[model samples]
Target: MTIETETGSPEAPPKTRLHVDEPLAAGATVGLDHERAHYLRHVLRLDRGDRVALFNGRDGEWSARIDGFGKGWCSLAVDRQRRPQAPEPDLWLLFAPIKRTRIDFVAEKAAELGASVVWPVLTRHTDVARVNVDRLRANAIEAAEQCERLTVPDLREPAKLDQVTRDWSSDRTILLCAEAGPVKPIAAAVAGLKPGPVAILTGPEGGFAKDELDGLLKLPFVVPVGLGPRILRADTAALAALACWQALAGDWATGGADARPPFRSQEPG
Candidate 1:
Protein backbone atom coordinates (compact mmCIF):
# COMPACT_ATOMS: atom_id res chain seq x y z
CA MET A 1 0.00 0.00 0.00
CA THR A 2 1.24 3.43 -0.93
CA ILE A 3 1.25 6.11 1.71
CA GLU A 4 -0.51 9.37 0.91
CA THR A 5 0.10 12.80 2.31
CA GLU A 6 -2.71 14.96 3.71
CA THR A 7 -3.31 16.23 0.17
CA GLY A 8 -4.29 12.72 -0.91
CA SER A 9 -1.37 12.45 -3.32
CA PRO A 10 1.08 9.58 -3.25
CA GLU A 11 4.06 10.57 -1.14
CA ALA A 12 7.35 10.62 -2.95
CA PRO A 13 9.45 7.72 -1.69
CA PRO A 14 12.86 9.28 -2.33
CA LYS A 15 11.83 12.79 -1.36
CA THR A 16 11.40 12.09 2.33
CA ARG A 17 12.68 15.20 4.07
CA LEU A 18 13.96 15.32 7.64
CA HIS A 19 15.05 18.25 9.72
CA VAL A 20 18.23 17.41 11.64
CA ASP A 21 20.53 19.35 13.95
CA GLU A 22 23.80 17.92 12.66
CA PRO A 23 25.78 19.89 10.10
CA LEU A 24 25.26 18.64 6.55
CA ALA A 25 28.24 18.59 4.21
CA ALA A 26 29.49 16.36 1.45
CA GLY A 27 30.72 13.01 2.86
CA ALA A 28 29.49 13.87 6.36
CA THR A 29 27.62 11.10 8.16
CA VAL A 30 24.48 11.72 10.21
CA GLY A 31 22.67 9.38 12.55
CA LEU A 32 18.96 9.21 13.34
CA ASP A 33 17.45 8.25 16.70
CA HIS A 34 15.18 5.31 17.36
CA GLU A 35 11.95 7.20 16.61
CA ARG A 36 13.11 8.43 13.22
CA ALA A 37 14.83 5.12 12.54
CA HIS A 38 11.57 3.30 13.13
CA TYR A 39 9.77 5.80 10.90
CA LEU A 40 12.08 5.29 7.92
CA ARG A 41 12.63 1.60 8.36
CA HIS A 42 9.20 0.34 9.36
CA VAL A 43 6.77 3.13 8.51
CA LEU A 44 8.26 4.02 5.13
CA ARG A 45 9.90 0.63 4.63
CA LEU A 46 12.94 2.30 3.12
CA ASP A 47 16.09 0.25 2.58
CA ARG A 48 19.80 0.87 2.25
CA GLY A 49 20.84 3.10 -0.68
CA ASP A 50 17.49 4.93 -0.58
CA ARG A 51 18.02 8.65 -0.92
CA VAL A 52 16.50 11.19 1.49
CA ALA A 53 16.66 14.95 1.83
CA LEU A 54 18.02 16.63 4.92
CA PHE A 55 18.00 20.22 6.11
CA ASN A 56 19.65 21.74 9.20
CA GLY A 57 18.19 25.27 8.87
CA ARG A 58 21.70 26.74 8.45
CA ASP A 59 22.91 24.28 5.81
CA GLY A 60 20.15 24.80 3.23
CA GLU A 61 19.29 21.28 2.08
CA TRP A 62 21.27 18.20 1.07
CA SER A 63 20.61 14.85 -0.48
CA ALA A 64 21.80 11.80 1.41
CA ARG A 65 21.90 8.04 0.90
CA ILE A 66 21.03 5.51 3.59
CA ASP A 67 24.35 3.94 4.53
CA GLY A 68 23.32 1.70 7.42
CA PHE A 69 20.27 0.78 9.53
CA GLY A 70 19.35 -1.38 12.50
CA LYS A 71 16.47 -1.89 14.89
CA GLY A 72 17.02 1.37 16.71
CA TRP A 73 19.08 3.64 14.48
CA CYS A 74 19.79 4.72 10.90
CA SER A 75 22.74 6.47 9.30
CA LEU A 76 22.98 8.37 6.03
CA ALA A 77 25.88 9.78 4.05
CA VAL A 78 25.42 13.35 2.81
CA ASP A 79 25.65 13.97 -0.89
CA ARG A 80 25.66 17.34 -2.67
CA GLN A 81 23.63 20.38 -1.76
CA ARG A 82 20.20 20.63 -3.33
CA ARG A 83 19.27 24.21 -2.48
CA PRO A 84 21.26 27.01 -0.93
CA GLN A 85 20.09 28.69 2.23
CA ALA A 86 17.96 31.71 1.42
CA PRO A 87 16.50 34.47 3.53
CA GLU A 88 12.83 34.43 4.55
CA PRO A 89 10.55 37.32 5.45
CA ASP A 90 11.04 38.50 9.00
CA LEU A 91 7.36 38.16 9.93
CA TRP A 92 6.16 37.16 13.41
CA LEU A 93 2.81 35.89 14.67
CA LEU A 94 1.79 36.82 18.22
CA PHE A 95 -1.51 35.42 19.45
CA ALA A 96 -3.31 34.64 22.67
CA PRO A 97 -3.66 30.94 23.42
CA ILE A 98 -6.93 29.27 22.49
CA LYS A 99 -8.25 25.69 22.67
CA ARG A 100 -5.85 22.83 22.07
CA THR A 101 -6.84 21.89 18.54
CA ARG A 102 -7.09 25.45 17.25
CA ILE A 103 -3.78 26.42 18.82
CA ASP A 104 -2.12 23.45 17.14
CA PHE A 105 -3.70 24.46 13.86
CA VAL A 106 -2.39 27.97 14.37
CA ALA A 107 1.17 26.73 14.89
CA GLU A 108 1.08 24.51 11.82
CA LYS A 109 -0.43 27.17 9.58
CA ALA A 110 1.91 29.84 10.90
CA ALA A 111 4.87 27.71 9.87
CA GLU A 112 3.44 27.14 6.41
CA LEU A 113 2.75 30.87 6.09
CA GLY A 114 6.40 31.72 6.82
CA ALA A 115 6.22 33.27 10.28
CA SER A 116 9.76 33.93 11.56
CA VAL A 117 8.55 33.74 15.16
CA VAL A 118 5.54 32.31 17.01
CA TRP A 119 4.73 33.83 20.37
CA PRO A 120 1.88 33.36 22.83
CA VAL A 121 0.68 36.43 24.65
CA LEU A 122 -1.55 36.08 27.67
CA THR A 123 -4.45 38.48 27.67
CA ARG A 124 -7.21 39.18 30.20
CA HIS A 125 -9.70 37.35 28.01
CA THR A 126 -7.47 34.42 27.15
CA ASP A 127 -9.06 31.30 28.64
CA VAL A 128 -6.23 28.86 28.17
CA ALA A 129 -3.88 28.87 31.13
CA ARG A 130 -0.94 26.82 29.84
CA VAL A 131 0.75 26.34 26.51
CA ASN A 132 2.75 23.25 25.61
CA VAL A 133 5.80 24.79 23.99
CA ASP A 134 7.23 21.39 23.12
CA ARG A 135 4.12 20.42 21.23
CA LEU A 136 4.10 23.73 19.42
CA ARG A 137 7.74 23.22 18.44
CA ALA A 138 6.99 19.74 17.21
CA ASN A 139 4.12 20.98 15.08
CA ALA A 140 6.33 23.73 13.70
CA ILE A 141 9.08 21.24 12.84
CA GLU A 142 6.64 18.94 11.09
CA ALA A 143 5.15 21.84 9.17
CA ALA A 144 8.59 23.06 8.14
CA GLU A 145 9.47 19.61 6.88
CA GLN A 146 6.25 19.31 4.88
CA CYS A 147 6.34 22.87 3.53
CA GLU A 148 10.02 22.82 2.55
CA ARG A 149 10.93 25.77 4.72
CA LEU A 150 14.64 26.25 5.40
CA THR A 151 14.04 27.13 9.04
CA VAL A 152 11.35 26.64 11.66
CA PRO A 153 9.81 29.64 13.33
CA ASP A 154 11.42 30.55 16.65
CA LEU A 155 8.92 29.54 19.33
CA ARG A 156 8.76 31.79 22.37
CA GLU A 157 7.36 30.98 25.80
CA PRO A 158 4.05 32.47 26.88
CA ALA A 159 4.22 35.98 28.28
CA LYS A 160 1.70 38.46 29.56
CA LEU A 161 0.39 41.04 27.11
CA ASP A 162 1.86 43.91 29.08
CA GLN A 163 5.26 42.27 29.32
CA VAL A 164 5.38 41.49 25.61
CA THR A 165 4.38 44.99 24.60
CA ARG A 166 6.73 46.63 27.09
CA ASP A 167 9.73 44.66 25.86
CA TRP A 168 8.77 44.83 22.21
CA SER A 169 11.35 46.23 19.82
CA SER A 170 10.53 49.68 18.50
CA ASP A 171 11.94 48.78 15.11
CA ARG A 172 9.44 46.00 14.50
CA THR A 173 5.85 47.00 13.81
CA ILE A 174 2.91 45.05 15.22
CA LEU A 175 -0.22 44.67 13.08
CA LEU A 176 -2.92 44.19 15.67
CA CYS A 177 -6.12 42.58 14.41
CA ALA A 178 -8.60 44.72 16.23
CA GLU A 179 -12.31 43.91 16.21
CA ALA A 180 -13.34 47.30 17.54
CA GLY A 181 -11.20 50.40 17.21
CA PRO A 182 -10.17 53.21 14.93
CA VAL A 183 -8.43 51.05 12.33
CA LYS A 184 -7.25 51.04 8.77
CA PRO A 185 -8.28 48.36 6.33
CA ILE A 186 -5.65 45.62 6.39
CA ALA A 187 -4.69 46.02 2.75
CA ALA A 188 -4.51 49.80 2.96
CA ALA A 189 -2.47 49.64 6.15
CA VAL A 190 -0.01 47.19 4.66
CA ALA A 191 0.32 49.26 1.49
CA GLY A 192 1.30 52.35 3.45
CA LEU A 193 4.20 50.73 5.24
CA LYS A 194 7.56 49.68 3.82
CA PRO A 195 8.40 45.99 3.98
CA GLY A 196 10.39 45.49 7.17
CA PRO A 197 10.32 43.44 10.36
CA VAL A 198 6.65 43.05 11.37
CA ALA A 199 4.41 40.97 13.63
CA ILE A 200 0.70 40.11 13.52
CA LEU A 201 -1.13 40.01 16.86
CA THR A 202 -4.51 38.37 17.25
CA GLY A 203 -6.57 38.42 20.41
CA PRO A 204 -8.24 35.47 22.15
CA GLU A 205 -11.65 34.05 21.24
CA GLY A 206 -13.28 36.25 23.83
CA GLY A 207 -11.29 39.19 22.46
CA PHE A 208 -8.93 41.46 24.31
CA ALA A 209 -10.28 43.42 27.22
CA LYS A 210 -10.89 47.10 26.57
CA ASP A 211 -7.84 48.11 28.59
CA GLU A 212 -5.62 45.68 26.71
CA LEU A 213 -6.64 47.15 23.36
CA ASP A 214 -6.05 50.66 24.68
CA GLY A 215 -2.60 49.78 25.96
CA LEU A 216 -1.59 48.29 22.61
CA LEU A 217 -2.83 51.36 20.79
CA LYS A 218 -0.49 53.64 22.77
CA LEU A 219 2.53 51.71 21.57
CA PRO A 220 4.16 53.53 18.67
CA PHE A 221 4.90 50.27 16.85
CA VAL A 222 1.41 48.86 17.09
CA VAL A 223 -0.87 49.49 14.12
CA PRO A 224 -4.41 48.18 14.57
CA VAL A 225 -5.90 46.97 11.31
CA GLY A 226 -9.46 45.93 10.56
CA LEU A 227 -10.22 42.74 8.64
CA GLY A 228 -13.73 43.75 7.59
CA PRO A 229 -17.25 44.06 8.94
CA ARG A 230 -17.52 40.44 9.92
CA ILE A 231 -15.83 39.24 13.09
CA LEU A 232 -13.42 36.32 12.79
CA ARG A 233 -12.38 33.72 15.31
CA ALA A 234 -8.98 34.02 16.93
CA ASP A 235 -7.35 31.48 14.62
CA THR A 236 -9.07 32.87 11.54
CA ALA A 237 -8.05 36.41 12.35
CA ALA A 238 -4.41 35.49 12.89
CA LEU A 239 -4.08 33.62 9.61
CA ALA A 240 -6.07 36.18 7.65
CA ALA A 241 -3.91 39.01 8.89
CA LEU A 242 -0.76 37.06 8.03
CA ALA A 243 -2.01 36.27 4.55
CA CYS A 244 -2.80 39.93 3.96
CA TRP A 245 0.64 41.02 5.13
CA GLN A 246 2.44 38.50 2.96
CA ALA A 247 0.35 39.29 -0.11
CA LEU A 248 0.90 43.02 0.30
CA ALA A 249 4.29 43.57 1.89
CA GLY A 250 5.92 40.20 2.55
CA ASP A 251 7.72 37.59 0.40
CA TRP A 252 4.55 36.65 -1.48
CA ALA A 253 4.71 39.95 -3.33
CA THR A 254 8.04 39.01 -4.92
CA GLY A 255 7.95 35.20 -4.95
CA GLY A 256 6.42 33.25 -7.79
CA ALA A 257 6.83 30.11 -9.85
CA ASP A 258 10.42 31.04 -10.70
CA ALA A 259 11.41 32.25 -7.26
CA ARG A 260 13.57 29.14 -6.74
CA PRO A 261 14.96 26.44 -8.93
CA PRO A 262 13.29 23.07 -9.13
CA PHE A 263 14.54 20.27 -6.91
CA ARG A 264 16.85 17.85 -8.68
CA SER A 265 17.16 14.33 -7.32
CA GLN A 266 20.65 12.86 -6.79
CA GLU A 267 21.63 9.23 -7.21
CA PRO A 268 23.93 7.42 -4.81
CA GLY A 269 27.40 6.75 -6.16
Candidate 2:
Protein backbone atom coordinates (compact mmCIF):
# COMPACT_ATOMS: atom_id res chain seq x y z
CA MET A 1 0.00 0.00 0.00
CA THR A 2 1.33 3.45 -0.88
CA ILE A 3 -0.72 5.21 1.77
CA GLU A 4 -2.54 3.86 4.77
CA THR A 5 -5.49 5.44 6.51
CA GLU A 6 -5.86 5.07 10.22
CA THR A 7 -7.38 1.65 10.88
CA GLY A 8 -10.79 1.68 12.53
CA SER A 9 -10.42 5.47 12.65
CA PRO A 10 -8.30 5.20 15.82
CA GLU A 11 -5.08 3.41 14.95
CA ALA A 12 -2.30 3.67 17.49
CA PRO A 13 0.51 5.98 16.38
CA PRO A 14 3.78 4.37 15.34
CA LYS A 15 6.44 3.92 18.00
CA THR A 16 9.39 4.75 15.72
CA ARG A 17 11.44 7.70 16.96
CA LEU A 18 14.05 9.73 15.09
CA HIS A 19 16.26 12.53 16.29
CA VAL A 20 16.33 15.44 13.91
CA ASP A 21 18.17 18.76 14.06
CA GLU A 22 15.33 20.95 12.90
CA PRO A 23 12.77 22.89 14.88
CA LEU A 24 9.49 20.91 15.11
CA ALA A 25 6.01 22.33 15.12
CA ALA A 26 2.55 21.44 13.85
CA GLY A 27 2.22 21.75 10.07
CA ALA A 28 5.98 21.89 9.56
CA THR A 29 7.48 19.45 7.08
CA VAL A 30 10.66 17.41 7.56
CA GLY A 31 12.66 15.53 4.95
CA LEU A 32 14.36 12.24 5.72
CA ASP A 33 17.74 11.62 4.16
CA HIS A 34 18.55 8.49 2.21
CA GLU A 35 19.72 6.45 5.19
CA ARG A 36 16.81 7.40 7.42
CA ALA A 37 14.45 6.96 4.48
CA HIS A 38 15.75 3.45 3.96
CA TYR A 39 15.06 2.63 7.60
CA LEU A 40 11.52 3.87 7.31
CA ARG A 41 10.68 2.30 3.97
CA HIS A 42 12.69 -0.91 3.66
CA VAL A 43 13.68 -1.71 7.21
CA LEU A 44 10.38 -0.94 8.91
CA ARG A 45 8.28 -1.48 5.77
CA LEU A 46 6.26 1.60 6.39
CA ASP A 47 4.01 3.10 3.73
CA ARG A 48 3.01 6.66 3.12
CA GLY A 49 0.71 8.14 5.77
CA ASP A 50 2.15 6.04 8.60
CA ARG A 51 2.90 7.98 11.74
CA VAL A 52 6.31 8.45 13.36
CA ALA A 53 7.41 10.38 16.38
CA LEU A 54 10.08 13.06 16.06
CA PHE A 55 12.23 14.82 18.62
CA ASN A 56 14.80 17.55 18.00
CA GLY A 57 15.95 17.90 21.63
CA ARG A 58 14.60 21.42 21.60
CA ASP A 59 10.93 21.51 20.56
CA GLY A 60 9.87 18.40 22.49
CA GLU A 61 8.38 15.28 20.93
CA TRP A 62 6.07 15.51 17.95
CA SER A 63 3.82 13.11 16.09
CA ALA A 64 4.52 13.20 12.38
CA ARG A 65 3.08 11.26 9.46
CA ILE A 66 4.77 10.00 6.32
CA ASP A 67 3.12 12.32 3.88
CA GLY A 68 5.20 11.26 0.88
CA PHE A 69 7.78 8.60 0.22
CA GLY A 70 9.75 6.64 -2.40
CA LYS A 71 13.10 4.90 -2.79
CA GLY A 72 15.61 6.69 -0.55
CA TRP A 73 13.36 9.69 0.06
CA CYS A 74 10.59 10.50 2.53
CA SER A 75 8.75 13.51 3.87
CA LEU A 76 6.84 13.80 7.10
CA ALA A 77 4.01 16.11 7.98
CA VAL A 78 4.28 17.18 11.58
CA ASP A 79 0.91 16.80 13.24
CA ARG A 80 1.04 17.43 16.99
CA GLN A 81 3.42 17.63 19.88
CA ARG A 82 3.46 14.83 22.41
CA ARG A 83 5.93 15.25 25.27
CA PRO A 84 7.39 18.56 26.35
CA GLN A 85 11.10 19.22 26.21
CA ALA A 86 13.03 18.92 29.43
CA PRO A 87 16.60 19.80 30.40
CA GLU A 88 19.12 16.99 30.49
CA PRO A 89 21.58 16.76 33.36
CA ASP A 90 24.84 18.55 32.72
CA LEU A 91 26.91 15.49 33.64
CA TRP A 92 29.67 14.53 31.19
CA LEU A 93 31.49 11.19 30.86
CA LEU A 94 35.09 11.86 29.86
CA PHE A 95 36.93 8.57 29.63
CA ALA A 96 39.88 6.98 27.87
CA PRO A 97 38.62 4.89 24.99
CA ILE A 98 39.00 1.16 25.41
CA LYS A 99 38.25 -1.66 22.99
CA ARG A 100 35.75 -0.80 20.28
CA THR A 101 32.82 -2.67 21.81
CA ARG A 102 33.60 -1.60 25.37
CA ILE A 103 33.90 2.05 24.40
CA ASP A 104 30.60 1.76 22.54
CA PHE A 105 29.07 0.35 25.72
CA VAL A 106 30.32 3.40 27.60
CA ALA A 107 28.64 5.73 25.11
CA GLU A 108 25.32 3.89 25.23
CA LYS A 109 25.30 3.65 29.00
CA ALA A 110 26.27 7.29 29.32
CA ALA A 111 23.37 8.33 27.13
CA GLU A 112 20.96 6.13 29.03
CA LEU A 113 22.19 7.57 32.32
CA GLY A 114 21.46 11.13 31.10
CA ALA A 115 25.00 12.37 30.45
CA SER A 116 24.91 15.60 28.51
CA VAL A 117 28.25 14.88 26.85
CA VAL A 118 30.52 11.90 26.09
CA TRP A 119 34.19 12.69 25.55
CA PRO A 120 36.98 10.41 24.35
CA VAL A 121 40.26 11.02 26.10
CA LEU A 122 43.73 9.72 25.31
CA THR A 123 45.83 8.93 28.35
CA ARG A 124 49.36 7.56 28.81
CA HIS A 125 47.97 4.05 29.18
CA THR A 126 45.32 4.32 26.51
CA ASP A 127 45.62 1.38 24.10
CA VAL A 128 43.40 2.79 21.40
CA ALA A 129 44.77 5.84 19.62
CA ARG A 130 41.51 6.79 17.89
CA VAL A 131 37.77 6.25 18.11
CA ASN A 132 34.88 6.49 15.67
CA VAL A 133 32.87 9.47 16.84
CA ASP A 134 30.09 8.69 14.40
CA ARG A 135 29.57 5.27 15.86
CA LEU A 136 29.52 6.73 19.35
CA ARG A 137 26.96 9.33 18.32
CA ALA A 138 24.79 6.69 16.67
CA ASN A 139 24.96 4.59 19.82
CA ALA A 140 23.97 7.57 21.90
CA ILE A 141 20.99 8.27 19.64
CA GLU A 142 19.81 4.68 19.75
CA ALA A 143 20.11 4.64 23.52
CA ALA A 144 18.22 7.88 23.82
CA GLU A 145 15.41 6.50 21.68
CA GLN A 146 15.14 3.27 23.64
CA CYS A 147 15.20 5.07 27.01
CA GLU A 148 12.66 7.76 26.07
CA ARG A 149 15.25 10.48 26.31
CA LEU A 150 14.21 13.65 24.52
CA THR A 151 17.77 14.47 23.53
CA VAL A 152 20.91 12.57 22.60
CA PRO A 153 24.17 13.20 24.39
CA ASP A 154 26.79 15.25 22.61
CA LEU A 155 29.78 13.14 21.45
CA ARG A 156 33.19 14.78 21.22
CA GLU A 157 36.14 14.14 18.98
CA PRO A 158 39.15 12.28 20.33
CA ALA A 159 41.71 14.46 22.05
CA LYS A 160 44.76 14.08 24.24
CA LEU A 161 43.98 13.80 27.96
CA ASP A 162 46.39 16.57 28.89
CA GLN A 163 44.91 19.08 26.46
CA VAL A 164 41.36 18.27 27.48
CA THR A 165 42.19 18.92 31.09
CA ARG A 166 43.90 22.18 30.30
CA ASP A 167 40.85 23.48 28.43
CA TRP A 168 38.23 22.11 30.80
CA SER A 169 35.79 24.53 32.36
CA SER A 170 37.16 25.42 35.74
CA ASP A 171 33.75 26.26 37.17
CA ARG A 172 32.72 22.62 36.78
CA THR A 173 33.95 19.86 39.04
CA ILE A 174 35.91 16.96 37.54
CA LEU A 175 35.72 13.68 39.45
CA LEU A 176 38.68 11.45 38.66
CA CYS A 177 38.39 7.69 39.36
CA ALA A 178 41.79 7.06 40.86
CA GLU A 179 43.13 4.00 42.67
CA ALA A 180 45.65 5.95 44.75
CA GLY A 181 46.04 9.10 46.79
CA PRO A 182 43.33 10.49 49.08
CA VAL A 183 40.24 8.78 47.65
CA LYS A 184 36.69 9.25 48.79
CA PRO A 185 33.71 7.04 48.03
CA ILE A 186 32.13 7.90 44.71
CA ALA A 187 28.91 8.84 46.48
CA ALA A 188 30.64 10.96 49.08
CA ALA A 189 32.75 12.62 46.41
CA VAL A 190 29.64 13.73 44.56
CA ALA A 191 27.71 14.70 47.66
CA GLY A 192 26.23 18.24 47.62
CA LEU A 193 27.07 18.62 43.91
CA LYS A 194 24.17 20.00 41.92
CA PRO A 195 22.84 18.70 38.64
CA GLY A 196 24.57 21.19 36.31
CA PRO A 197 27.98 21.22 34.62
CA VAL A 198 29.79 18.23 36.16
CA ALA A 199 32.10 15.65 34.56
CA ILE A 200 33.64 12.29 35.55
CA LEU A 201 36.97 10.98 34.27
CA THR A 202 37.62 7.22 34.02
CA GLY A 203 40.96 5.88 32.89
CA PRO A 204 41.85 3.01 30.58
CA GLU A 205 42.09 -0.61 31.74
CA GLY A 206 45.82 -0.27 32.49
CA GLY A 207 45.10 2.83 34.57
CA PHE A 208 46.74 6.19 34.10
CA ALA A 209 50.50 6.66 34.05
CA LYS A 210 52.20 8.19 37.06
CA ASP A 211 52.76 11.50 35.31
CA GLU A 212 49.18 11.58 34.05
CA LEU A 213 47.86 10.68 37.50
CA ASP A 214 49.92 13.41 39.06
CA GLY A 215 48.73 15.91 36.48
CA LEU A 216 45.11 15.08 37.15
CA LEU A 217 45.52 15.20 40.91
CA LYS A 218 47.19 18.57 40.73
CA LEU A 219 44.29 20.07 38.78
CA PRO A 220 42.63 22.41 41.22
CA PHE A 221 39.17 21.42 39.98
CA VAL A 222 39.71 17.66 40.03
CA VAL A 223 38.52 15.41 42.88
CA PRO A 224 40.01 11.93 43.10
CA VAL A 225 37.42 9.29 44.02
CA GLY A 226 37.26 5.51 44.17
CA LEU A 227 34.40 3.21 43.25
CA GLY A 228 35.00 0.89 46.23
CA PRO A 229 37.66 -1.34 47.74
CA ARG A 230 37.47 -3.41 44.55
CA ILE A 231 38.58 -2.14 41.14
CA LEU A 232 36.18 -2.05 38.20
CA ARG A 233 36.72 -2.31 34.48
CA ALA A 234 36.85 1.01 32.66
CA ASP A 235 33.37 0.63 31.22
CA THR A 236 31.97 -0.61 34.50
CA ALA A 237 33.51 2.27 36.36
CA ALA A 238 31.92 4.81 34.03
CA LEU A 239 28.45 3.35 34.35
CA ALA A 240 28.75 2.84 38.11
CA ALA A 241 29.92 6.39 38.67
CA LEU A 242 27.07 7.76 36.56
CA ALA A 243 24.49 5.69 38.44
CA CYS A 244 26.00 6.72 41.76
CA TRP A 245 25.87 10.37 40.86
CA GLN A 246 22.29 10.05 39.64
CA ALA A 247 21.10 8.29 42.76
CA LEU A 248 23.07 10.50 45.08
CA ALA A 249 22.99 13.97 43.52
CA GLY A 250 21.29 13.70 40.12
CA ASP A 251 17.67 13.61 39.06
CA TRP A 252 17.06 10.00 40.07
CA ALA A 253 17.24 11.10 43.69
CA THR A 254 14.24 13.35 43.17
CA GLY A 255 11.99 10.32 43.60
CA GLY A 256 12.43 10.92 47.34
CA ALA A 257 14.90 8.09 48.17
CA ASP A 258 12.00 5.63 48.70
CA ALA A 259 10.90 5.45 45.12
CA ARG A 260 9.80 2.31 43.33
CA PRO A 261 12.16 -0.39 42.12
CA PRO A 262 15.01 0.68 39.86
CA PHE A 263 13.33 -1.16 37.01
CA ARG A 264 10.93 -3.99 36.42
CA SER A 265 12.27 -7.28 37.80
CA GLN A 266 10.37 -9.73 35.64
CA GLU A 267 12.26 -12.88 34.70
CA PRO A 268 13.59 -12.97 31.19
CA GLY A 269 11.52 -14.73 28.59
**lDDT agreement of model 1 with the native:** 0.88
- In model 2, the number of clashes is 0
* TM-score, every prediction: 0.91, 0.88
Q: Flag regions of model 1 displaced more than 4 Å.
A: 1-13, 260-269
lDDT (0 to 1) per candidate: 0.88, 0.84
Residue 219 accuracy (lDDT) in model 1? 93
Error of 2 at 11 (Å): 5.8
lDDT for each residue of candidate 2 in 77-126, tens digit (9 for 90 to 100): 99777667876678889999999989889999999998998999999889
Instruction: Score candidate 2 by lDDT.
Output: 0.84
Per residue, candidate 1 scores C-alpha lDDT tens digits across 75-150 of 9998767678989889999999999999999999999999999999999999997999999999998998888888
Against the true structure, whose TM-score is highest?
1
Span of 10 residues, lowest total lDDT, candidate 2: 256-265
* Model 1 root mean square deviation, Cα atoms: 5.8
RMSD to the hidden true structure, all candidates = 5.8, 5.0
Q: Alpha carbon lDDT of residue 131, candidate 2?
A: 93
